[model samples]
Target: MEEKCTTLGKLELEAQNWFVKVIVAEKTPIRFLRWRRQQRLVFVDKENERMQSIIYEQDVDQLDKLLELYKTYHVGNAKIREITGNTPILGTSKHQMILSRSTYIKRTEEHERIPIDHIYQFTPFSELPEIADVPTKQINLLFSVIHVFPPRFVERTKRNLQDFVIINEERRALILTLWEEFLQSEAPYLTKNVHTMPILISFALKF
Candidate 1:
């Protein structure tokens, strides 16, 4: 038999308003919109790849807690557990907060807690795995700098793919291809001077 759970007490809400409050794991996209009926469904923007989220008639008190945490904390070193209605509430270990993968999607705004260094190995294991025997390969990285010919009046058929900053740290720079709709001005803006940069630099396809 399904247990009959007690419904929460009367919440002060305007008519035609369905209030829901959820703790967001990642920052929502800048361009986000949701109609009243569509709000019943989780995925708003399929291109963003943020289709997973828990959607239900949530308590307003829980929403208040979420707003408080969002405003109080900065990007790094923010505490979310103290909030009353935080889903997947407890941390697995003392150092890690285990918010489920689905909660991470369905972001409605741009607000996320970034790590200090913002640099971490993308591999699955923190330490070396004991299972598979991996073959070794001596990859020779070729380094060269192709200068920008005629900086002004630049008619780039491709995007950042046309530009190259070849360096020899025995590392190969990722070759990115740009789309026709993309402009050259936007190219410089896409790639930033980051202290911790990703090796696999490539064109971001919205679709």
Candidate 2:
């Protein structure tokens, strides 16, 4: 019998096995925690619904090798659970997927069903004042880079921090901060073209 594919929005905690054919929308670098290494991948279903998934220390390497940005995959045998506590949940779905060594993940050919681009619901700069008052919610912003400051190494936190001045179509400006890994990977490019006014779309930004 063939496995039936399910959309991210249809996933429920009660289901032990989930079969999803989705595009790998976003992938993060492995984060080193005190006890374990972890990585996150955001998958987008045919409906354009996204869900965040975690690969713990054990499965990080294996899955990282298999998953790539904007690629389509058939996923199954992954555990689904409700997100709890302070962790900022991504997408419309409240539940998250957990992948392990036993999880079935196979990269498949790209199809028109799933979107290759990352999904973001951008909030206007004029509305930021109200949204800033609500700290619990994460929002997306679209802006142009007006300035990029030199990266600073913080001895106390052992992290690199960089700042960028951005503005929206209304010319309203705001300061954006980039921390740690983003400095090494994203800062240089933004800094190089800061004067050219590059358009930037930031996802999941919180006050």
Candidate 3:
């Protein structure tokens, strides 16, 4: 008998004992919230549907290290949840998956049908002001790195953050801030080659 698999579109808050084969698309740095560490991730199914998953502090150490960007895995025994309180500032789906200790994720061969390319709606810098009034300030931006500053440590938030000077084709300039993992992973090379003006795309940004 063939194993059963669920797609992101078919997941519901009441469902249980579901399995999904997906590719890790985007992963956010571990952030400190209320003194606990938590991380957010976006996964893509074979149908190109995107859903966000959150790992709480307790599960972060175990699951966060196991998952890698663009890697495919078979996930099961996870919790499906309804998004509430405020509009999602990062993910595309109305529902989210919560990973716990009981959740099982097995490394799997990359599904050929699952796209590896990032799906983004790059919002222009010129349009940022127009959407500022919207309840959800989430937007995506693509820009060229003109300058990168040294990383900083905040005593208040107990976090690391870095700022990058970016510009668009229209020559509109803005400061892009990156936190946590981005500083350690991406900022080093970008800082060294700021003069070369490397292009970068950032998603789910606040205006």
Candidate 4:
């Protein structure tokens, strides 16, 4: 039984757990459409200001039933704030806050657990600093060419090869897999070479 309280009122949603919360708040002209799934939710507020909303989640089949109950009456707490685009925040305690930052993240693979190799020198983008500064949870980036292990030990397929990497320390650099278009259009920049390193790119959790 998960506690479901509404901002308009303090009510519990025990039977039905409606994860998607769409808030059309009173006195505000912003549109906030929110939905939660797979531990990820899409919160959108077209207006450029702090918007208010409500949301709750649990396990149930009759999500619509719970949602209708919420619309008819008032449940969970209100005040789901969407202050800016790409950056979402929600109020939990009286004084605490939660920040949802979308960033470029790479996952570790079984082979990546050990050291691999990758190409080092790259054609640095002039606008990289500015693009990195923008407050965004997700950014699109690509790698030119990465030196990798011979096909003997590593398994790679047509497009999957572009998806591979080897993260060496400062000794060499990590170049992530760029999309096929970037790889094809900018083919000359990342030419395949036997000397390049083969490794994976991963994120060291930030505190």
Candidate 5:
């Protein structure tokens, strides 16, 4: 018999096992109707696909454990098993469709901490092939800050803040754009010592 495929929407109602290679993305508090409770933990698949899972007020202990693991070990790739519960779906919105009940996670791989000096050996900015020249959509880089421009207000669907910083290694210089949160936090520090400090940039996705 052929095995069935499980999607985010159908996990709870169907008594089936779904296996996925996931990395913990984030955990945030959420409000639901009159009940100002429940936490949402976000996960990204091996391919960088995102999904949000729900944890109720009663599951605060589980949340605490997960948070501790996240802080200490920096929750890397893991195998997660869903624990079906009678939790009601939060809303009829598109976001609600991606929410799932509690899960039991087991780390499949050990987290390896790479030394800061050795980062370039893994993914050097100099060796990055042009986007059109490469098959994959992602590239990693390590760069030093050359200059940082003032933060600017961009009018999107709503007003959004952005900052542009010029960074370079020995071979090339590139501009990195920081969105709202990163712009506010890191930009100030980076701008202050743009000429003196050495900044390393490594990203899993294409910027």
Candidate 6:
């Protein structure tokens, strides 16, 4: 039988007998109001490969059942299958696939753990001499917010809006620019007692 695949990584998802050990990196509702309609889950495999999968409306129950396991356990061994009648958008099959269902999932035992700490380490901002010098082209930063700027509109082809914020960890500080969607989604927390709140930037770019 031909193998199935995933959307973001185009990784071949074999049938029930083939298992992949992964860690849940993120999970978010597709829409704030109608969460059951669709949802997104991002995972990192043992090889440090990242991929995203969507939970369709029809699979909401599966998501509900898997949520606790994913959140509490962090790591799991999952059996992946491909969904039929689903194709990549725009005809580009680069890194996208429709998975049928998660046949099985269980907490990954200690012996099954893969040493991928180097790929997801939280490094001190000061340790990086320059953003351009980051080997992986991605950095994970964790710090407390120092200041946040109000949203501003810029004259662009589509009338763009931007938001700015400053974060600090001890003596290190970094300025972050947020676009409209991010500003709106994070506005509440950004405007509150931000100095006391800590945030982790999982994938931040130097540029």
- Give the C-alpha miss distance for residue 143 in model 6, angstroms: 2.1
1 against 6, candidate with superior lDDT: 6
Query: Best TM-score goes to which candidate?
Result: 2
* lDDT (0 to 1) per candidate: 0.25, 0.81, 0.80, 0.27, 0.46, 0.51
lDDT string for model 1 (1-207, tens) is 012111111112221222222222222221212431111111111112111222223322232234322221211111122223322211111122112222322223444332212211122121113312322211223233332222223356433234434333444443333333333443454444322342322211111
Query: How large is the C-alpha RMSD of every model relative to the true structure?
Result: 15.5, 2.9, 3.6, 18.6, 10.1, 7.6
What is candidate 6's lDDT per residue for 55-77, written digit by digit as tens? Answer: 66666667646654233223222
Give the per-residue lDDT digits (tens) of candidate 4, residues 1-207: 113322222212222332222222111111223654212222211121122233233422223233221122222222233345543332121111111221111222333221211211222234445555443322322232345322221245344224434333334344444443334442333345424532322221011
Candidate 2 RMSD computed on C-alpha atoms after optimal superposition onto the true structure: 2.9
Please provide, for model 5 over 10-66, each residue's C-alpha lDDT reduced to its tens digit, 9 standing for 90 to 100.
Answer: 334333355444444445434453474666554443333444556556665555465
How big is the positional error of residue 154 in model 1, measured in Å on the Cα after superposition? 16
Model 1 scores a TM of: 0.23
Error of 4 at 207 (Å): 17
Q: For candidate 5, report its TM-score.
A: 0.42
Stretches of candidate 5 exceeding 4 Å from the true structure = 1-129, 132-136
Q: Which stretches of candidate 4 lie over 4 Å from their true place?
A: 1-38, 48-57, 60-126, 130-207
Best by lDDT: 2
How many clashes (backbone atoms < 3 Å, residues ≥3 apart in a chain or on different chains) does model 6 have? 6
Q: Roughly what TM-score does model 3 have, to 2 decimal places?
A: 0.78
Q: What is the Cα-based lDDT of residue 174 in candidate 1?
A: 34
lDDT of 4 at 128: 43
Better of 3 and 4 by lDDT: 3
TM-score of 6: 0.55
How does candidate 4 score on lDDT? 0.27
